[model samples]
Target: MGRPRVTVIDIAQAAGVSKSTVSLVLQGSPLVKGTTRAKVVEAMNELGYVYNRGAANLRQTGSKSGIVGVVVNDLTNGFFAELAVGVDIVVQSAGFVQFLSNTGESIDRQREVVASMREHGISGLLVSPARGTDPSDFAPLVEAGIPVVVVVRSLPGGKLSSVVADNPSGVAGAVRHLVSLGHRRIAFLGGFQDTAVFHERLSGYRSAVTAAGFGFDEALVVPSAPSRAGGADAVARALAVEERPTAAVCFNDAVAFGACDGLRSHRLEPGRDFAVVGFDDVIEARTAVPALTTVSVDPQAMGRRAGQLLLKQIAAGGVSSEAVMTSVRLVVRESCGAPRLAAQA
Candidate 1:
């Protein structure tokens, strides 16, 4: 027994069919007549054959051509995972293979992933850039003639087509909810101050607070990482102030979680001690120790729409600054404390 030689050719010969027919049958192609496919299968079982899927795929697909590249900040985040599902549906429907790259919020890493995708001959790209990334960072894909779409956030100067949530309106809705519950002293946490999306949200927060007959105190607003540490730090810092806000609105759920953790560290419960709210109602929001009151952005819909946009551009030989804005909703949960004491009285 030298190498246990067995091949598709041998199976085809034994089954009394051509090698092409055996290949078709093995690939599950409907092109093969049922009787012929049954005969090929019977011969395969009789010969103890082991099909090499990698080689078979290569032979059938005629090379590694149907690749679509998706670059996200992190895969561990449920938001990105949901987005991936949406991307997959469209890619699969179009008979394309998907390649996912997590950049871990590193601008340099994003560049590397793009370079690798270009080298691999990806047909198109969908990206959610790291914080503070420049539109020029995506220049390589454009120069290489690869169609690309930015999801969730747009690059500075509106250079790329994007599918993003209506941050201002979403924040306004959140603030109005807090106001209705009699929250006058409200604060904001997380989110980079300079980004377009954050700037819009901050404006909405300020506008809402003012319209609700409350002074917009800059002291209550905190800028921190959109991570747990950022949330915790913001809460601690806000609590240190002479006039601590009775409620806090976060950049996203991660920040809100951290804020809740920070509050607990100080022996204060998040919902009962002070109202807390977060954006981007991630999967964990509902399942957290006390469910998170957050703004829900449809990540899956954004992903699918982004894929569709990029594919459309690819098919039409590129497009101009087309914008698609999706809506957001406030999902109230355990956090973001009850109506004010005065209102209760």
Candidate 2:
């Protein structure tokens, strides 16, 4: 027969304390003296006792579970990975554990994971929503009074807190910098037009182009996957135009690298023959062969801020539904011919 289950009563008996004392220790209550708490923990450890947090959470009404759910569209993306890590750093430090889920950009998978997290009784949630996630999709969580902090992308018409970078201003700055470097024929590459991020960045690109006294040529804007392969495809299309672009501002770093690869395939050296700029300024951007010039969003900082916001909402026991637009900046490097221009001066 299997060994009998070890109960809190068993721990209490071994520790020579009351069951109430054991309960206080399990709840991490400060009211329990340090030495007494230590004794209870030691007794539980010796007995190989595992605390069932889920069961304990069910017993207490209106009590914090000390768990936060974090869901991201694509965990494989370095940007999203860093964002999750940032959220973990803050949440862990605040005595909370995070239940992380990857949706791989599937709305259905996102819903499943979010539902599973709800079943686990998470106090709050941080979500980088998948494509086509409607505001109504989160209505249940809102109705249940669970706080949610959206990151990276915004869900239209949702009364939920969100943390997003200034895509418009960042993309505009990239365009302005390229124009300053004598890139008269510039192309916007990568990212599907359906996404809010794509529209925001594209709007900035158009405004910057018009502001620079250049006609907005629709032919120069190529839509593709926001990945390396997509960037390559977009660049090929941009080059096929009657007025081939001399430089391009890509959707993100992955697309920028793809553009560089595409340029090389055509026997053109990036930075020397064609300039390229990317957004996100991912970790690899600095270490890449040409050192990509891009807009910096600081994904980790965004995650930390998002975590803080979620925790704040959890403490208040309600959603603030605030929208935070974080700032971004341009990071000039070799890929955009900035270093070469500097050397000439």
Candidate 3:
């Protein structure tokens, strides 16, 4: 007896439909009529059909080896970890494997990781750049027909597609909330004067402060690290000043945690003696000693949308520069208190 050959062709013949119809059904294209889809599925089951690379291509509409690369600045941060979950969900659903790469915010390391991905046949890249990274580093991939999507941060003057949270709006919202509390002496911590992300947040802070009729105090602003240790060190020094701020708005929750710790070490309760707020609403914010008041960015949603956008671009054969912004909002917690004046007003 000859070997039994079960192909999509056999399934199409049994279903009394064209091969393209069968392909459309398998690909879950909405264009396939409902009744025809049911009939094709029934035929596929009856013929004991087998799937092959062609059917796979019909489903994905891409030449990837069922794999894509997801790169981030720091994996240790919970924000990125949550974002990774969102990316994974979309990749798995599309029948593609997700290869996670952490650059630890190192530009050199990021380049190395990209090279490795290319060697392994990964043609798609999703990245959140490290500080001071050069967009030109990925120019090679861009020229080689690979798709690259930026998340969390946009490269200056680089014509790459990106998805990020509205840092300005989020920061402005936080600052405005504090101003409503009558805190005229609020301070910003954990940010330098440069970097797009930093500037976005800083600009929003300034706008809110100005709109509230307060002067921007460079004396109150402290440049520090975005991590807990960096937060601790900066806060300790700021607290030693003759005129300390009644409220401190941190760059992110990690820095907020450090600030809170520093306040405690100095016998000051964050929400009592002074108010503190953070950004990025990492999971730890909800469980901090005095729960952190923060702006929450839904990393998972951002990741899922980014992945879908990349796939859509691939399906369309190519795409021009597109930017997507995820929404952000404030989560009130124990860490931030209404300034005495706001309470009276």
Candidate 4:
């Protein structure tokens, strides 16, 4: 069996000190002598005694713990990572510790982490809900009066406050940019239809297509995993059809990269033989071969804003159900066959 967790009692015994003295040292009370404090510190280090600050705070005053929980769908993605950093910037400065968890888009996993965080006495939670997440999934936390700020994907008709990108406007701008470059048959590629993000982006493409005086061809919309492999698969399927599109807009940067890889496999060159556009201007987008053209939603800014909103609710002791929509801009670059001279906007 694994060793039991080291505790304050163990520290006190190791230092030859009383339990009350150990507690006083832990609390940084000046009344404790320097030599005794050093002895306790030495014992704590040797015993690997980890403090449960959050739990101790709750026990001390029965008030909110100075800890905030951040649960993301995919921490592996650079977008989410940067977003978490933004949250940390605000949370850390506010004297709150962060508890981060990656759900990998599993509803069960998300629920478990969120519940566990609550038990540990987190004052608030910031989450990027998994696909197909029901509004009811956060019911217990909501009932318990924890402020939750949903970022990225939002629960439609949910009573939760949300902070998300302007998905429709971002894609609409991308479609317009492609059209301006003479790509009449631009295809919307990659992303499962199971998400509200998918529908909003698709809605933009459809409106843009009809606005350009072309009938909305449902055939032009291809759905796949919101991943690089899925992007490549979507391209393969789109190419298999009788009518081929000269240009495509992808769900995200990962898919855009995969679409480029798929194009190369078929002896086609991205930015030369076929034009591709991606959403979410992740860090890798600029450095990728042929540089991905994408919608700049500023994930970090969105995250910072979400953190600020959540802290506001925590301070107010109220939930507003206020949804915030951040704006986006299209960054024209090489993947769309645009000149390499176009600097990132």
What TM-score fits each model? 0.77, 0.82, 0.78, 0.81
Error of 3 at 86 (Å): 1.1
- Expressed as tens digits, the lDDT of each residue in 193-239 for candidate 2 is 87888999999999999999997999999999888899899999999
Stronger candidate by lDDT (1 vs 2): 2
**How accurate locally, in lDDT, is each candidate?**
0.81, 0.89, 0.81, 0.87
Residue 197 lDDT (model 2): 86
Model 4 TM-score (2 dp) = 0.81
Question: Between which residue pairs do clashes occur in model 3?
Answer: none
Ranking by TM-score: 2, 4, 3, 1
Q: What is the Cα-based lDDT of residue 70 in candidate 4?
A: 99
Cα-lDDT of candidate 2: 0.89
What is the TM-score (0 to 1) of candidate 1? Answer: 0.77
- Stretches off by above 4 angstroms in model 4 are 1-57, 61-64, 340-345
